[model samples]
Target: MAERLLIGALKSGKNTKIVTLNGKKMTKMPSTLGKLPRLKTLDLQNNLIPKVCPEISALTQLTVLNLGNNLLEEVPEEMKYLTSLKTLHLFGNRICRIAPGACDGLQNLILLNLNNNQLTELPQEVNRLKSLTCLNINYNQLTSIPRELCFLEDLSELHLNYNQLICIPEEIKFLKKLQKLFLVRNNIEVLPEGICDLKKLRILDIAGNIIQIFPPRFQDLKLREFYCEENPLILMQPFAAKHQENIWSLKEITSRFVLNQLAEENPFLMNAIEHYPEVRSIISGGKNCAICGKFFLTVWLECVQFVPPSKNWKISKNLQLVPLRILLCSYKCFNQRDPNLFGISQE
Candidate 1:
């Protein structure tokens, strides 16, 4: 019966571009599907097909392919032939592995849905999908994603929910165009400092994680919606404490002096830094005092300031105040800090 339908479809027209054979219960893809060279859309979802036939790769002009809810165990290598593909849906499959070169030919792919699969990790080749904007990998067993995934600068919406992800890469700041991030139901304990660099992020869902505190300057983000539930948040207990006197180590003293010298852009020191990569790295990691504006390394005072929710923000009504972590150069700066900035008690 499926063969007859394929034969009839072939005779339907010479310019036939769309084919809908979903739920046909066909166990194998008919080789005749290759005959539709100009086919732009192929719908073979909700079927028992175990794998995609290599013959389908002949459809070079295919733009959209739906193989959702199929018996596929892996993404076929032939998928690389669909260079013009823009949207590919493989959701609800048992796909556990993707051929390395499978993404090599998908340069124009925009939306990839790999949700509800058995994928444990994404291939580094995913970086080749430079035009991808929306990638859905929810409901998988991914514990850690390849850093290459963060190389997708055009990505705007990322769905990593229902996974075992313990942490997001600090390189996530590379997705400058990212707007919505869903990290719901993960084991993530901390958000990277680089996350604060995503100035375009607006909607964030970090609910159900074990996060106790947000990264520094997290309140600077102009978010419209914030969902942070089911996590153990620290209580806000405003109190007054005196900054204790502390002695600086020899290494700390040298690092502070070098950081100060680098700020003046001394030509000789700048050239010497090129030879000592460690020095350059330490200078880059230097933090400035919030009160005195002095650079410091390895030694600083940690504090928190409460941020009242803005009128335009759509935050949970249960949240009246949010704590933003801050760092100061020394105890002296902590002593002179604004009355609102409170030092976190180590006791």
Candidate 2:
């Protein structure tokens, strides 16, 4: 197709400001695209383009660049000229070497997608993308990440799944804004200290790795999802989590919700309760039963890894709530109640 016609199609009108020509697989971008001076977004994905067309640099107003699923071998040095480009998607490409000073001109880049490439190492120039917030580099040939990457201060989500990573950098703990971390299917060994100090981390997915000792310190975390499956992690340190009555995985989940009615009144020992709806009709936090010596229904709470716009989370219901350990005393047995001895209240 003629380049002028394509640029004419990628125009703005009224309140709209986007144009798409995705999956075109054009070996060459139209030479007439520079005519669309008002263009703000460009999507040219799933193409067979062997190289990043330098003509793209003329579109200085571009904010989005989608050249994914193409046969691209290297991003053109001219790409640095698109300083206004913020989101660049180049996943599933034949890229082997990122041009040096690649991130130098991208002063406002917020999102970068370079997954599924043949990259053996990342360019140190990546640290220059100061405004970058999210990055996706899954299924690559990376051996180790640069330690200077700690400079991505505003980065929130980092996806590095299916890489050849053997160890996590200690400076990674410095990414205070990191919310989600996906470390699945790697060759990592030990986890570093203060790994749990990422107070804002919400989703931590390290499944299918060689993890040994999981940190025994997660009490201060406001976690909502925690997945360490397929690792050699042993028992969770119950005491380290400050569980008052029952064994809790972490702290935040303590008596947050209480179910007060019991169906069987005296639930069978070996038969575990299945789902919540089974006890839904019961009144919550109302009365104690004579047989169970506590509230009729059970109460439970769970945790979630509290990471950021990160792409690391287990697709599981990873909630760990410990039930209150109540004394099973008969009313007649309670007549002989020793409040001080059992720490019971008989007011």
Q: What are the root-mean-square deviations of the candidates from the true structure over C-alphas?
A: 2.1, 17.4
> Taking the tens digit of each residue's C-alpha lDDT, what string does model 1 give over 71-154?
999998999999999999999999999987999999999999999999988899999999999999999999998989999989
Give stretches of model 2 more than 4 Å off.
2-7, 10-17, 216-219, 234-347
lDDT of candidate model 1 versus the reference: 0.88
**TM-score, prediction 2:** 0.64
Model 2 Cα lDDT, one tens digit per residue, 96-208: 88897667789999999999998888888888888988988899888888876767989888888889889877788788888888888888886654466687788778788
User: What is the TM-score of each predicted model, taking all chains together?
Assistant: 0.92, 0.64
Give the lowest summed-lDDT range of ten residues in model 1.
234-243
Query: How high is the CA lDDT of each candidate model?
Result: 0.88, 0.64
Query: Candidate 2: minimum summed lDDT over ten consecutive residues — where?
Result: 301-310
Choose the strongest candidate by lDDT. Answer: 1
